[model samples]
Target: MIPYVRDIKFEYGAVDQVSPLIRRVVANNPGPFTYVGTGTYIIGRGEVAVIDPGPDIEEHLEAILKAVEGERVTHIMITHHHIDHSPLAAPLKARTGATIYGCAVTKVVEDDGGVKTEAGYDMGFKPDVSLCDGGEVSGPGWTLESIPTPGHTSNHICFALKEENALFTGDHIMGWSTTVITPPDGDMSDYMDSLDRIRVREFDTLWPTHGPPVREVTPFIDAYIAHRREREAQIEQALAAGPSRIRDMVPVLYAAVDPRLHPAAARSVLGHMIDLVRRGRVLADGAPGPDSEYRLAG
Candidate 1:
């Protein structure tokens, strides 16, 4: 069965009660990457916990304040340090004195001679309280357990709401599109591992930052894992057939896909090749970059 995605017609500051435990206020920033803007989630009743405050847009900040007008926002949590996710955390913290929580700054790996990709970090963000895997934070009637599912970004985390049996999946998982896993920071190996991590967990639903909630948890997880593995197989086959460069493989592998999307697809292919090289399945001349040549390992 296909996942049922809720169509949210958001008006900047309006608060929509998604469930008894959750209210969502979407920021105005919408795009291909962010389906209908960032849905800043307000969890719990009186003393709420705000997750992914979204971009630094002042209007978004005002909207959150209005949503929790009479209630106290005790905790502010970030899924990752990307510009669209963590920029507003500082303002929310200052206004409510809410304790900010998130994973520490992303750790930069020594460039493996691969194409160096920068996903633009929010360098100013420093969580007042750092959350590690299995850490718990509570407010009013809800408790969220931090699941460090790093892949979309080195510091990405998903919060599992204990009361709702739902996971607040950051960009690590989204309903609208497959995640962009650029290497050095975004690891295909780690991304696949994280998907497997979530597959084993007990969650009935997922609340992603961008689009609607995912209801078919197990099937969606299974399909996502299978889709990526299939993509890897396609890349390996292409390599075996002699498409040595990413640009060359793009047309061969992504012929049916939009030409405009090929550039991004090429990056994903590079990430897969890097992982393949690490696993000894494929060989790259140097670090996996657009210019790097690849071949099946003998």
Candidate 2:
């Protein structure tokens, strides 16, 4: 596993320590884990664009306002409309009067098979302008293209800065964890295509919604692609060993995977098994559901 300290960068109504143009303002609700609620940062230009304001903490929002004290904040961009990432958009707009931009899929009210994140939590914020693919946001010296990167969520889009050579990759590609392709909202084909898009693009840095910026991005993207491919092989091997269940494949397929993250690993295995069934490489007898089972297809 790649281990790195995710330092936050704070400046101008925005917090830094995350990247050259990125910042992380600590939120109120840290989250379900020990090291959580690190929030997110703004990317590019003196008049910046904030990505994922994080959970709604009055202090955090106030800190953001203070961080961007004198700067005329132009835009508030949503990475995927996830609560932990976006809840502050509306409130911040009330505070700073900046236009919010995101995708239709993101602000669609429900995320990931009707899972309500913002409702239970106070992190709900909607966008003023929701965009689709190939859209551009131009300011005086900065221009960001809305690059569609639908995988972690169909609404998930990354922002590409033209002049600065940076991409704000929401949860699409983070330094800490492989993106979870949780079905319905997430699609494997779209995620792979998004990875392909990054491989062919020219970008010096990556500002992800969650983790730290990957200074040299292309290599990390390549590595992500390789990681996914490797996982695919591992799944197939686990299947061929004999008839199996997600529980059965866990040890053989992800023995080296973090024990604490087994449930997540199981989710990935579910996606893999679904794909394998489609390709006729494996048969499922309720392997992921009641009576679900799996075996070598051919």
RMSD of every prediction:
2.8, 4.1
Worst 10 residues of 2 by lDDT: 114-123
TM-score of each: 0.93, 0.81
Q: Give the alpha carbon lDDT tens digit for every residue of 1-298 in model 1.
A: 3354657566777999987899999998887677788899999989999999999999999999999999999999999988789999999988999999998777754535533233356867789888955599997789999999888888889999999899999898887767889866788899999999998996898999998888888888887888888999998888777648888888989999988778778888878888898899998888777689899998
111-202 in candidate 2: lDDT tens per residue? 33532212222224456887766588876567778887887777777888777688878778776556777654556667888889877886
Model 1: worst 10 consecutive residues (lDDT sum): 110-119
Best model number under lDDT: 1
Among all candidates shown, the one with the greatest TM-score:
1
